[model samples]
Target chain A: MIEIPYNVKPRQETGLYNAKLGIWLFLASEVMLFGGLFSAYVLLRVGSPVWPPGGEAQLNIPLATINTFNLILSSWTIVKSWIALKENDFKGFKTYMGITLLCSLIFLVIKYFEYSAKLHHGIFPSTDNFYGIYFTLTGLHGLHVIGGLIVNFYLWGPGKKMWKSEPERFTNRVEVSGLYWHFVDLVWIFLFPTLYLL
Target chain B: MSSQNLEHHKSIYLKVLLALFVLTVLTVAVSFFDFGSITLAILIGLTIAFIKGFLVAGNFMHLLDEVKPIYWLLALTVVFFFVLFFMPMLWEMNLVTVE
Candidate 1:
């Protein structure tokens, strides 16, 4: 087999495995992707007569607050999952990853309720600027969460086979996924304040 | 990493998580009080958000120990990200001041 360079170890000069470098580069672009929307948000809010396009009361602050903590906990658990791999405890890794997956589901469930509540009252992206930006930001973030959940679920399920054969690479893969998961959490940290609290 | 090192790292993660929880609560609690100025309130909230971001990126994502190249990569991203954020405001000012 033709070997993929720097799969398990850092490249001599760059000091990161190929996957790590690639993921970070991807995340940098992701930053700009969201940054563009956030910039638009600033423009819209500044130009609008009223802030929050939807009234401030229209948002479910308590549910969003719960969702924020839910994401934070998932970030913690995913890191623990990676750590468990380091300890050579696959069971520990599975347990933590399961919890992390559960956290993702709980987050989306709360979001579903939030969205449904909004839609039930005829609020939507088309409703006005507030609902528009609210849907745009949270909708994109929700997609990222689902993406992470799929990858993590695979890692918890079928992807564990890699561990038996190539444990180091498996660990690196987990670390990379954990990094992406953390970035998702990081975005929400800012988003929660930007959209809900502030 | 040694078992000792892994154990030590685990402790750090726990501490960061605790800090995140407290700061999140702080984010909500501060919203309840009147801060007198909207910008000041925003500054306070975003400062807390940035701290939370630092904890996640620095500790959870291991950027504190990350390589120089990645830092440079992200630094460029930050520059452009801010440019993207501020470009509209700059444009708005230009339009307002042009007349």
Candidate 2:
């Protein structure tokens, strides 16, 4: 393996910048974290009774599918925001960011509707094997969405100068946050069919 | 910068975005087929999830820009996860009853 030096004089071109590399590494760890949950989900599902839980416990596939599209659209908007920031279009970045946040809010609204419906129907984490894993996994992912939204609030805050003067750093923030946001959305990509549709 | 520059790069990013969208639709469509088993559906879904993850990580997150050293680190993390998780999986698989 050829060793690439990290240190350089301020004026020199560094072969690879630190922020981009660092975010990738951070995302790798995030992958592993989600990987654990996914693997556990598979094991539980395979070992349990027929999926969607037969008789009165079946999932609402239509509701879940709608939410799935909601999240996937959010991921696209996040990428659009990142691209806008890269081009030094702060207004465009803000517009995309706003759309992303709105998509996220829409996701949560759909989720709350689904969750509340479940609760009203007497389904919950303590209900049974299937519901237990369902609530735990999706609930955990929801918490992350809330966390991502908080970060998005700051990244898109009013009068913030980061996106204009320091485009690289701004892009980094968007990219890293996008990485996390996409992972959250990606988890639902699987969760959609598994918990509800399948 | 230039609108021309934007036009030049637009198709590439749009193409990838389109791929992501198509793959998502494919995932939803595949879930409707029972495949005669839930495990098969999960396997298919997770496989797509990994592919989507790859695109998001490599392109959206810019992991592909990293030097080889970072790849090594990622390799190590993956190997560790497999070794750590699969052993328990193996044990669970051997048990006569999953419950």
What Cα-based lDDT does every candidate model obtain?
0.91, 0.72
- lDDT per residue as tens, model 1, A1-198: 999989998998988899999899999999999999999988998897778644664888999999999999999999999998998999999999999999999998999999999899988789888778889999999999999999999999999999999999999999999999999999999999898887
Off by over 4 Å in 2: A1-22, A52-57, B1-10, B37-39, B93-99
Model 1: pairs clashing at backbone N, Cα or C within 3 Å = A53-A130, A54-A130
**lDDT for position A148 in model 1:** 97
Recovered share of real interface contacts in candidate 1: 0.95
- Per-residue lDDT of B1-99 in model 1, one digit per residue for the tens? 457766777889999999999999999999887999888999999999999999999888877777899999999999999988898899888843555
lDDT of 2: 0.72
Against the true structure, what is each candidate's TM-score? 0.95, 0.81
Docking class of 1: high
Cα error, candidate 2, residue A29 (Å): 3.2
CA shift of A15, model 1, Å: 1.1
Clashes of each: 2, 0
Instruction: Go through the candidates in order and give each one's DockQ.
Output: 0.84, 0.36
